[model samples]
Target: MRFVPLVLAALLLIAGQTAAARPPSAVFLNVVAHQDDDLLFLTPDLSQTLKASVTVYVTSGEGSHPESMTPEDYAEMRQAGERNAYATMAGVANRWDRVALRTGTGTTAELATLRARPSVKLVFLRLHDWSDLHGLWNGEVASGGTVLPTGSPARVEDTYTRDKLTKTLTWLMDHFRPTVIRTQNPAPLSGFYAPDPDNPDHTAVARFTNLAAESYEGKAQVRNYRGYDDAQLPTGLDPALRAERTKAFRAYADVDTNVATLFDDTASYLGWRQTMLNRWPSGVSWTDGADEAYAVLGDEVKRWRRNVFGEWGKPVGLGGSGFAPAVTVARQADGRLRLFSLNRNTFDVVTAVQDRFGDYSGWTSLGNPNGPGGDQTGLPAAGTDAQGRLWFFVRNGGGGVSARQQNADGTFGDWQDMHGWGVQDGLSVVSAGGRLQVFATQCSARLYVTATCSIARLVQGESGFEWDTSVVPGAAATAPTAVAGTDGKAHVYFRATGTAAVLMAVDGVVTDLGNPGGPGEVAATATGEVYARNAAHGISARGASGWRAVGGHTEASPAVVGRGVVSIGVDGRLTQLVH
Candidate 1:
């Protein structure tokens, strides 16, 4: 008890102070439900943490792979592996140490319960193993875990409790007192925790994180990072190992999964490369889920994955298939978030209930019996309009030829073939200065933000869809970003090409805000006072003057908040861009 008083208080002070530091801003405590889980959902985040040298705490690696070993032997080997893994991840053991401690349960468990405890300065957290079983990832049936029933997707131990984990976690926090903490979001988990069965560990982690950070209130930020999706890993024992290393990076990096551009590097370049090869001894596994994985991802994207491997023996493939259904995610004029979707043959609004009741579809959409891209136009970018009619920028995907439709009324529109313009992101459909403003990317990879009255073209057969274009002349945009500004102007930025892979921003005035280029899209910001994303840096705005790199770095598309915007970067760290 006396130790608690002294140690806990010290932990809190250190955690708080560490958060306010210059760059390498915050410290982190990772409470992954399983070993490989963090690798899947939290990879980039880890990269960012490592870059900042933030301390990490890991748990659960014993029970998983152990299904293959006796409890005693398995625990010993797994603990050794865990130690090796963390040591490799943090880059040093003098600054990092592995301790056998039970996490969620809080109460001291036997040595077997201890998983990962790093001794980096200014950090404290329980790295207790839920079961080393955390190494095995599952959830997606098509990805193959549906049948392999021996690992973590099958967590069967309750040796711990919320109360137990809380006491210990709180003690760590009181000790570390991190002003900004991280955990997985447990609320409305789509694949599992459906309608609240509540056996999952996320809820526990979130609840605990909430409680632990409560005393700090507005004084702190308890960010919820997405845990891994073992459901998506390629089926391979070595992939399992490699996956852990990836997770370590992403969790530290903090970027969204769908959009992050993975710059491939030799496995050896990462610390885990040599160690994983030495320890796990790759190229061996009981099951082969690669084909099934290829089947799920389809061919084109699989080709992208294949391109990365080159001719590396038997190539892994997710097969060639289009993509899953496109769901509309945008706020409606009626003050509710709606998801309009059509898959298979069903068509309807996706269930938009949010944390209000039970047995609810987190987001269910009925497919359009009329086919996905009905008529000449199919799916549209979900954007809200002036009158609040949600705009759907439908694309045929054959090329830039797409149409616009309104979800409130099933009635659709004709298609507009902007053949050369490959639509980037649906930035905005603002009716600021008379006509509707449309901004997107060109097939040539330049920025294009138009003040067009194209809504009528999609609805009618008229030829004139007022499209005004502004290109950065010769700027070859690797990843383009555009957003509307409160100053009555639209701004566009893109990752530059060739020698200066820098990101550049240009104000799509009826003119120019001048032009400036930088190092990474991770450094650019949207053009004005209204900010949409909290973690985006690759997209920034130059005032009537010049450069202010938005936040640290983010991958999610930027969206303007009412006044201030949450900017997320490739690094996944976020800052508010307050006008």
Candidate 2:
């Protein structure tokens, strides 16, 4: 392994700091397909956190360059561009110290730390771009293949099969221990709005990153960003922020001849620079009961009790395994709290019930009606009817809603397919009177590309559930969260498609709650107070007195527990703030 003298000193200093000070409170990891992907699609957010960020370039980013520029040379050039861009973002000199790293999997990778800001690092796996990733994804690539970038000091030889790539990513996660892992969209828009679709390499990298995250032991929150298709979405950044982002990209453009024109003619790259959208914005699950709050930390369910002073006690873990990070809590007629979650490995709906003494039973699989594959099922949502019967709902494999209700004997009935198509995840089920109301975002096409998307409501009728296809006005971007208000009306909350503005619909009337939006489902309390994640990842609550900032950097939506709000912190711990 080779490292410059300065880099060696920096590494020793970093090691010393690691031994002395506490680990970073927040470490943001950006895993992208190409060198410039983060600058183009994930910037502003990327630049904003330069002090606590590490970006990984999965591919060499050598896309059809001129014959004069060899593939290795092109990869080096791109890496240089990225280094320069990140240096600019860090407000430091354009000098980076390169060090060779051997990942836990025994594969040699390159790590470049900004000379002035060691925390702003860049990792290059230097895998072949496009076809190689696609081949790995399809299992056509053989093991033992080797890729060596131009300036790589060691002979890093690895075939980069799907499993190997995923393992490598997991190894990186273990090394960095990021609080947030951001990647390109695993399921990118195609057909209508995206004629070209996202680069297959982007999708492949994202899928591998997510798989790695799932296999990783740490509690890192995974976020997916839109790739080229983000151009079709409305501009997410304001003018001032856009200007700042452009400066960083321009620094990169200066080093890369391929995108040099972007430096002078900024209009061509404006769409991508001005907009940054998350493929899955919703956060982890937190459910509020009468006196306690339940949150899913990693795969296990944890409960927090409220004391008489309205303060929440430290959480007690409710043991479960192989479950998704999101959970739904429903109250049983006998006052037990039942939790529902999707099985991460099998996509099956799993349930666990809390006993009278607050001890949780072992998780019981509810068997997915959407078949066995993990992708076929979404997170489960649970609610209790006026009759006090518990019902569980999930987005089935067919993009429709499937439900199961508690039987009179306490066991759940067979899964019933509530026929509606193209529904997204993050289903919200609220019970008012004797009926259950299910609100979700049903799109005509893929969410990022869809021109026709709305909040669809499925209301339980005397015969069965009937669908109100367009219950909310305007285009909805996220799955709707509905709560039955004290006025006995179902109040629906969703983020508007183009504006990202939080909107509430009640009795056919729509109210625009100002955009404090980042990405995630809008949450509402039982008493009608609304909460949504703001741009800074903090909670914003709108109550009778209007909107107020609820300070907490959370990984998911805030849960309203009685007079307090509960959120999962960036470190994957549950935090409750009493009003």
Candidate 3:
């Protein structure tokens, strides 16, 4: 591995600061399975966060049985290659000093320090890298299956009970105190990795990292990046960034030295380019782009929901400072209510739940169901079904539909592709007549003056969910909202193209309700009352007393909770009128 004594001596002689202590600008720690994993899955952002960053490799990339190289040679070469790769990323010389790091269990592992930039470091745990065997080990750790023994396999000496690993990780956190932590995807889709598909080692590392972080409860924010699934998804980076990534991987795969290596020319490393998808922390912005607007009413009030108590619990040093159209609300069967909103800081789907006693939980993220939803303009639709399953849908960045449902245990199922294409507008979902119906608007070029926008429907039937699209003609300019009325029929509402009049669709018939006042946000209640927000942001209902304004100015569209309606104020407080 070409260890030079001169560099080690110089690095040791000139050190007043430990790698753990640095200026509090930003410190990022990335925990990955193998050597090249961070480059393959966490990149451009990983490279961007280079200042004061530490990467921890759980496995030394030495397989259980090496066919062409000795285990020592393989481990050393992989470590050197990783040094070279990070050096290339930092645009500096490839010289690092090796040191010993004692874990919580009192055993030592190798830690490398970049000579040019002391802020960047690499810690190797030297664990076995067998795919099938380590996968089994990882699965056991993930499911709390078994406590792994220490000092097995003979080559690398450290033993790792899941608790020991977690403690060591917690020790690292307490030492470094990073501001941000990134790890691989701990959870993947069911059946997506059934037949020996994804790497189990990657999932295991991510889970262990999460456990450690939870135990430590440090100030650092955690983000989970997708691993092997990148190969199947579209490339997320542009050409320039992709070219730089190619260079980094080339360095990681270089193996012309005397030492045997895990990376060689035969591997398809050149073609390994794809977008890095991550579950951005609840309130942190992944990008600097201005927040996109949505035609749906609920999409605008997310900021109020996220920062209702100010910045006490905002994600990753971020706070909801302004208004955005990204809130949706659904009522649970037992008088509880769920408020869904896009994080003002991240623009990702985040939600808060209220119990029957009116106590609200902290806002939790469901992540971006679609990988950045095409153009970072993801429009979310949320509702509760007949069985109280909270369903979430998003118009993806590729202009396609994706969905997921909350399980009975309160966990969410993996996002499922609903296969609706060319859907660029906002979406609305309703559970009616024991069926879940999704409504969206699609535009098509016509033989007339301009393109025509029409409403499309996908409803669940005896044979499963089927598309009965373009059932009613509508404007493509704005989004649509739908709700199942107490009459056991579906009611859809939207603004007609180029008009302020609110249109209603029921039983495949479209009727105009006339313009009540200004732009109106509409919703149907449990009492069969169709309500809309008026010009002054007040709630008005089409009730037995005729269409009349009932409340004062509301910050956004009000949500139906049980038999009444509730709204949030600009000062981040909820006002419920139980009529």
Candidate 4:
């Protein structure tokens, strides 16, 4: 998998610029409960959020075993590796922060930060880490590996006390104010709905996370982004079969539906082979991410490479990361809620509420909506309007940007052409009042992340074909973005000759925010204060307090939800601002 250095560098340069442009909308407090959770569960999202802020709340290491490493040692190494990795990708390691909280496995941890920024802190409550090697099942058919259930989440034996668990989690909720929280399920064959009470650590994580969300009283969104209860270990699939699943798996490991960033986000993501999660046998440690130790080299009898990498990876039956293929949760200022993701092109909204999610195993047809076979490429931004109306906007290849509104009743509105005459490669939509605000970027040919969302729009003639307008100070002409701010104003920001151009409707009169950077993005928080991310920095401006973060790395537009708070999931992490 030798790639051209130049191409990768070029892509990075472009991607870097893009990151400074679009930036994500959601302010995520990664409710991760296990090790390598982001990779195995939300690879697609982690792929894109690499540029944003993500705080991992880990209970245990690879396997909740003292043999793996001491709690103190494990915490240091894990945090160090994580920080180094994040800095390598985001390029703004200094802006990030990390802190460890004290508590039992049953409790949660809360740290400090503003409404915006990666305000998440890790709570290494001394909970049992579910061993990829040991669980409900015993080793060898004769080993006594059976599914067990223990009642009460606080009863994880001598682990964290119930009181300790509650306090930790309470502190976490009160401090971060996370709207979207994620965790694992009780069992493998089951999902969030299933109940696996035996493992106190597993059960505690779920119970504790739920408790936090509940404490917020639906004021935040919650979802189990992981739960591959099955066996994360490789099936030792006779070589040939293993390769097949890996490719399909990579397709998903590539993109983030929410962030719209790159796929295969990890530095080693590209060269990843058959890193098997579980090895039916133990003999291996997934703690150090040691691929060689747990790998199979065709066994001489069968020369096949199953890239089984459990160490520092996900667990058995799970994505070797204790994560999911694709799970989208929509949270907002009001509270926590579930989000529906239409499997790629299948507009059919695959409702995998429990065990049925993505289970093509017993599955039939999903009636993909982006046309029969479906366009796995991408879908337009799906947002709800004031009237409780569900909206669907697509950057139809030839049909320009088409939009359709779906009501809670499952019905749809007429598909209208918002970007008339010409077509765009990207589509973003936000509702302000009764009107729908959409933003798009027209690619010269195909689409790329560099398709700036922050760029200001200088509408070409009438067809809307050319996007030669930008907000970047001194940057030449570039395409601009079309977005509806929270204050009921529409804005378009872009880059020009490295500079930036901001065009927005201020009381019917278009006003410029300022010159922060190029092909950048702008999001309004509470009172219509706009925050833009461009170049390798960010800019914020409101009433009197002008724009700041002059240095930002944005690749997606801001998704502002709360009154004074705005969340921005970038590169591969979640960062935000609270005024």
TM-scores of the candidates are: 0.39, 0.84, 0.54, 0.33
Question: What is the Å distance of residue 420 in model 4 from its true position?
Answer: 3.5
lDDT of 3 by residue, 308-345 (tens): 33222211212222112344455555555566655433
In angstroms, what RMSD does candidate 1 have relative to the true structure? 17.7
RMSD of each: 17.7, 4.6, 14.8, 21.4
True-structure lDDT of candidate 3: 0.57
Considering lDDT, where higher is better, how would the candidates rank from best to worst? 2, 3, 4, 1
The numbered model that scores best in lDDT is 2
lDDT of 4: 0.34
Residue pairs in candidate 2 whose N, alpha carbon or C atoms collide under 3 angstroms: 145-159
The true-versus-predicted C-alpha distance at residue 89 of model 1, in Å, is 3.8
- The models' CA-based lDDT, in order, is 0.32, 0.72, 0.57, 0.34
**Once superposed on the true structure, which residue ranges of model 3 sit more than 4 Å away at CA?**
1-6, 9-23, 64-66, 131-156, 190-195, 256-268, 279-579
> lDDT tens string, model 2, 177-244?
78788888766544324445677888788777877887666666676777775554445444555677
Instruction: Assess the local accuracy of residue 16 in candidate 2 as a C-alpha lDDT between 0 and 100.
Output: 11
Clashes of each: 104, 1, 13, 120
